[model samples]
Target: MITEQKPLHSGYGPESTAQEIVSDQDLRGKTAIVTGGHGGIGLETTRALVGAGATVIVGARSVDRAREILASLPNVEVIRLDLMDPNSVEAFAKAFMNSGRALDLLILNAGVSFPPELKDARGFDTHFATNYLGHFQLTLRLWEALKRSGNARVVALSSIGHMIGPIDFDDLHFNKRPYDKNISYGESKTACSLFAVELDRRGQEYGVRAFAVHPGAILSGLVRHLSNEDLAEWGVTRNVDGTYTSSGGFKTVEQGAATSVWCAVSPMLNGMGGVYCEDCDIAEVVSADSQLQYGVRPWAIDPTSAKKLWDISVELLNIQKDTIPNVGTNLDSDRLLNVSIEEPVVNGQLSFTR
Candidate 1:
């Protein structure tokens, strides 16, 4: 069933911090994987989850950097995983699954915005590839671990940037059109939202649920590429005196992580999935002014678009996996879409134990 895309009036708001949400929750034996878990709001998310007693594996492209950021944090392990590299992603997943641990929480919290480049090793657009495809491949690779947990929750860190536009499937790599950083970021984020919906549709029956979250606008490393002029344009509404004030609705790192943490461990959301959440609550649909800032837009959660993006991603991955004939992937999306891809391209011989 589609979860109602409306707020439950969660007692939390934009000012709520990650620690405040999980204060009373005990996650003693829970195991989680947080991509990009070393910096920005991702760091706060890791802190809160670990504080609640969950053993978290931080997937990082730079193991040294992750170690530096998470230095001495108990129950947190830093592993080398690059979202832009498929080989790295597969290797990380195989290592994790073969370790005999079930993943109870998978947070797709790492993403980039306004990158200076257009493509990666595979010639795919970096924003779309990193933000959406990397997470897609990782989740599929770890499906069995999530299923075995019997109560897994996958959270995708979507953004209000999704309101900027929906995805243009044909031009995902900017092959035909000119590349605009803002539009590309928006496309990647929209894909993130769609992935959650489709993932929940397929995984809910296996006791796994997925949700997409808009963490609200926060000053983080995420906007590294935004020039002062770009920042100025974005801050036209708020009093931008060299920094973001509360009037701009910008959140601190702690405040930004509230919704992601909420979606990951909230009992109030039990049995609900495929919803877009903000401010620590399931958001409402935008029914009035198109300029509404809070509610989820119609295009972001459209089931058809979600499935379409899923198909396109599978097709793209199938093509990318073509080079790796040494390993095979368990493309078991067949359960939901009746499309079976036993493509022999993964580096490991691991199987998805459906």
Candidate 2:
């Protein structure tokens, strides 16, 4: 029950770009996994990491689209991963592990926001499954690779939206109550934060660290479900040319990627394990009644709640303590991941878990 919350004032802020964060660092020989690395801030994060000489692996649903964005980037590999499908998540993890590479940085950067009311094949909320559950499973499956890396970091892409979440454990799947898309999205981010808190506690002993990051709002495809008017409702602006013009104060994608890059490679955070970060620095705890949009909420970083979420996730996946196999020492790169997910979500049926 010890606290791992607090800000260190490392001196970076909203204006910092990913390029600035890694200006003084070197990631040569390092290997990283960035989910959704081909899109939005995730793309910028990939650029930063690989620019520093890291070999970056991405779990992408559309390998073609991923290649289209990153074909020119060296040391970048794309594998099939549909975050909405548990089977694809497992295959991606298996493929990555089978490569026999030690994972130095794992950025769980893939996420969805503000989608229409939808449920997974398991009947779990689509936002929750895609944003939280899939990442949780992938991280667990890759735990050994991280530990083998000797000093690894896992950054979970959480958000300020977590402020609206107070997990309804009894009705987590929105089974009993009417569903609210925003609330479900918030709940998913909250789960991401809690996962990092608890994962850090467990993995710190193994030289692996975890962090939850709030990449500032940007007009990424994360909001494709919204229209121009819907975007305006949330302070996002779109131009007539089908591109974002401005967002009340949304950061550029490069700026949006700064905190992740900072958390991944900055020496200032060497001793830190679990913390919620925003604007390129550790965030301060805010009171529930506070009017400010910044700062981390106590509930989002609560250790008790973190443990509860961990247990729930473990149970949902039917994973036993020994389920994580030890395979980081030897990889069979000759094997291939079956890329058979023609449609990740089809006919309102989700087949995420076997």
Per-residue error (Å), model 1, residue 262: 0.2
Residues 167-220 of candidate 2 have per-residue lDDT tens digits of 889989888989888899889899999988888888787778889999887776
Deviation of model 2 at 21, angstroms: 0.8
Candidate 1 runs further than 4 Å off: 236-247, 287-289, 319-354
On residues 86-205, what C-alpha lDDT tens digit does candidate 1 reach at each position? Answer: 777777787887788989999998887887756876789888878889898888878878888999999998988888888998789998998899889889889999999999998888
Query: Relative to the unseen true structure, what is the C-alpha lDDT of residue 29 in candidate 2, on a scale of 0 to 100?
Result: 92
TM-score winner: 2
Evaluate residue 19 in candidate 2 and report its C-alpha lDDT on the 0 to 100 scale.
94
Which 10 successive residues of model 2 have the least lDDT summed? 345-354
TM-score of each: 0.87, 0.90
Candidate 2 deviant stretches above 4 angstroms = 1-4, 227-229, 324-354
Clashing pairs counted in every model:
1, 2
